[model samples]
Target: MMKMMRVAVFVFLFLGVAAGAARAGWDPKDDEKAQQAVDYIKKNAPALDRFFVHAYGFAVFPDIYKGGLFLLGGAHGQGYVYELNTLVGESTVTQVNVGPQLGGQSFSEIIFFKSKADLDNFKKGNFELTAQATAILIKSGMATNTDYSNGVAVFALPKAGLMADLTVGGQKFSYRSR
Candidate 1:
């Protein structure tokens, strides 16, 4: 009986390792970056309808979780980044996992730019919105008019059932690379 229990534990641990390694595979059906980015934007369209008629100055980033435990053998964890488009009021989603890490958080942000140059940079870079760039979480708690940086205005409202209203903003967005 003890031997059986030990074997079961081994199997569970083995499968967990395998599952963690395969965490970075995105949908292969449409393999196009632009299309996926569009789809991602459309999924959250209702939240961003205010910018619908505009020429396209909005980008959506999704939620991300970053963490991992490194075994004495090696380190492993996963996270993704996305780019979005709402030119025709139809958006797209694209995803890429950052690979193994020792420790860090997976974070996603939906960015709405007010300038054409910023939007163009988004397209050319395949949507690498990093801290080197400028960003803020609108729906995020403690987000206020004062916290905004750059020329960007963060307008966020509730999307899910979250009751986070420490302050009032604009859109309720959920974006991922998809």
Candidate 2:
């Protein structure tokens, strides 16, 4: 019963934070953070530098806050969208998850689009990363033998915290031009 109550309280806190984040508009700080995140990723996962050079575009989320307790979980983040290395817009990601999961974590995520069509699709505000879209965790000295799925490749670098999950979720995104 105590554990269940703690989970309930966590869910409420998560919802409050998510709601507050949804109302946040574009801020220059996001740009700064995004760039820092990109630099960090490049330093840690040098292999991903090739994608920055060749990919048509990408979205970089500097901090994605995710929390899960028992069977309910959610994540939210704000990011910048780029095309050919140029910042074109701002985007937000909200995810809902359900399954066996616990703990909270924060991470940086980048989604690379392989072609114009894929980038356009994301810009049109119709992009959602389904369960089929898996993100490779970028860790130093780790081999990455991954490829784009449906013209997009996702990578994540954990910033802090620990979480264990077997949950299924989809990330929904919204975009606005700068």
Candidate 3:
């Protein structure tokens, strides 16, 4: 029981620190930086144009910080969600995992909602990525052949960092109107 309590405290503290870090770097109202991020993704993976043109909505997180120590891990990031080229809201992603894991890394992630239902589910305030969901690493031709799985498609671009972690976690999100 004492060990479990210590683990709980560690997880809470880790998540609090990660949340603060995420908030420090994210400004939901910063449209200029958001656009730059979008541009970067588009420039690096032109194949994603099809998703931008066809997806009912999408969310882009300019940067995500993930780190783990021993049996605890956490990640956090803020993003903008758009529907049909119009900004609909701002969203935050948070993830926590428990397993044999360690190290830290940063990456950019984007999720494309293939239909209104999927977007609606995301905007409903409590949405999560199941363990089965996986993101494709962005590359020159990767997106060209990528297809949506279960009404959504995800792409990730590593910014910088190195980490060796074996963890199991699901990403959860909260949304707010812009």
Candidate 4:
């Protein structure tokens, strides 16, 4: 029984590691998802341009639903970034282990880039999400305030439906411009 337990433990550990590696691995759709997110930036380009240009930082969060058929909504999963149709960015994927809104919800977020230097940093393909980065869950809006002094821009908008900003995972991340 002892030997059997040891074997099971080893197998579990191996599989767990392998799973994490697979998810972290560069995903093909990641590029497409990143481009899709660019739409938000284009919509708010005037305001976004003032924030960053040539190369800058941006971040995005999409709707994550987790509830009944009619009440579907929740913010769960990771978001990626793209520039000039390239997969050159990643978000600090957050997993809400436990919370009051444990069911399902829908939300989305976007970060913009304005300078070549900052955008280059994002396309570097090795940078990770920073603790100071801010991410706000948006419900609806044409544009929001992106304090450039902080070297980051976080915007939130709703595709549809209503939600609270708190439950929206008010997180902050960076992204580059097109």
Candidate of highest lDDT: 2
**Which lDDT values do the candidates have, in the order given?**
0.37, 0.84, 0.82, 0.46
- Using TM-score, give the best candidate's number: 2
lDDT tens digits, residues 74-121, model 4? 233456664543555565433222122323345565555555555565
Scored by lDDT, model 3 comes in at 0.82
User: Quick one: ranking by TM-score, best first?
Assistant: 2, 3, 4, 1
Over 4 Å off, model 4: 1-21, 44-46, 52-55, 64-74, 82-86, 95-104, 113-145, 161-178
Candidate 3 residue 38 C-alpha distance from true site, Å: 0.9
Query: How do the residues 30-97 of candidate 3 rate in per-residue lDDT, one tens digit apiece?
Result: 77767877888888788899999999999999899988777777788888888887877778888877
Q: Estimate TM-scores for all models.
A: 0.33, 0.86, 0.85, 0.48
Output the lDDT of residue 78, model 2.
Answer: 81
Error of 2 at 147 (Å): 1.7
Better of 2 and 4 by TM-score: 2
Worst 10 residues of 1 by lDDT: 162-171
Instruction: Return the lDDT, model 2, position 178.
Output: 76
Candidate 2 on 7-82: residue-level lDDT in tens?
7767756675756454455677767876887787788778788788989999988888998888778888888889
Model 3 pairs whose backbones collide: none
